[model samples]
Target: MEPAMACHADRTAPVFQTKGLTKTYRQGDVEVHALRGVDISLYPGELVVMLGASGSGKSTLLNILGGLDVPTTGEVRYQDIDLAGASDRELTRYRRDYVGFVFQFYNLIPSLTARENVIAVTEIARDPMAPEEALDMVGLASRLDHFPAQLSGGEQQRVAIARAISKRPRVLLCDEPTGALDSATGILVLAALERANRETGTTTVIITHNASIANMADRVITLSDGVISGEHRNSERQDPNTLSW
Candidate 1:
């Protein structure tokens, strides 16, 4: 990894910093506040899990941090770049080069094989891993030729993860990665995420409603009513296999 590609290897230096961040959406005559005066810092290579109910600002905060949306007020800084003020082109470039997003849906092409799906992303990335290497990292080496229709829900999601990390993004943002799977399958998905983090040292933030998933995080952040409610750090992270919903 180049110096810029390294995901916050410097634990003391922040990869993402947000100050007094607020987001509001106008729905006809009403305004819905998504994030209100939120201040937080994410270190390099840290696995941070965000826990909150619906409308709690967890996904809103993640979207802002990932360059998918701009804040209404305050500041969002990814390193020294000011995201809140970045132009649409700048934000698009930022997302393409530095961010990897995984949603609840795998979004894999049904016609493409697993390897082909991963290759579609690696081809556009700078200093990316090969499609095979990426799948191997996510423990899908044996399933490379399998199409989305042939794989289980967890396996398909793993392919999504492989596609995301093949670019070697500095930050990995996952929203409800396991929301569509059962407990047994969810653990497998979480395990793939944990393994990717360990191998690539990508700064990972996962948004989840499951409290048990907190055990795998280096830090746990909570939000309520569009504001930060609490934050905590674990002395040591737990194995994903040991976690349950």
Candidate 2:
């Protein structure tokens, strides 16, 4: 594994920092700007909600931060490492070591039990939490032996979360994590997220279309047309019960 660059900043440093970051995709004669000169920072152990409409570039930004996509211009640093300039292998190692991701779809293997699914990641991880412990963290202790087909949508999502977090990554990025569920079930997913963030102290960034969900974040950022339009902080977080749709 490549050694991480030395960090000059103290504990106040952000887990991720982007300055004038931009990403453009080319298809035939047209160019699409998914993100436009956006500057942002994700702090350690804070839950941030990225709220916006469909074309707002929230997912694009999250993808870049997660090292799945690269920007066409500008700078992005993961801690002190230069992510924007990292080679493919370096980026792969970075993602493998420090990043955990959850998406809208629950991509578990139908034949694997919840604990087995979590173990799949733990095996490859450098230093991971026990699969059973991870499942318990997401309130799936009793369902550890259940297959994905037998689990509800919310339960499946929790298992996914357990799988992602079992590696004990420094950052957890979720893109539309609850988009597929009804409100009541979605709250369970949100509660899982809240519990994971509080207990593990992992820096988490969530991208969602629901404005009401922003109330639960330590900070909320809104995007529009590929740029950040607004950012704010809530003095106190609202529990899942208090969060509206």
Candidate 2 Cα lDDT to native: 0.90
TM-score of each: 0.95, 0.94
lDDT of each: 0.91, 0.90
Candidate 2 residue-wise lDDT at 142? 99
Weakest ten-residue segment in model 2 by summed lDDT: 1-10
Per-residue alpha-carbon lDDT of candidate 2 for residues 1-245, written as tens digits (9 for 90 to 100): 21221211124678889999999998899999999999998888888999999988999999999999899999999988898999999999999999999999999999999999999999999999999999999999999999999999999999999999999999999999999999998988998888888888898889999998887888899999999999998766778655556
Query: Which candidate number maximizes lDDT?
Result: 1
How do the residues 1-245 of candidate 1 rate in per-residue lDDT, one tens digit apiece?
11111222347889999999999999999999999999999999898999999899999999999999999999999998899999999999999999999999999999999999999999899989999998998889999999999999999999999999999999999999999999999999999998899889899999988888988888899889889899998767788887766
| lDDT for predicted candidate 1 compared with the true structure | 0.91
183 in model 2: Cα distance from truth in Å? 0.3
Per-residue error (Å), model 2, residue 181: 0.5
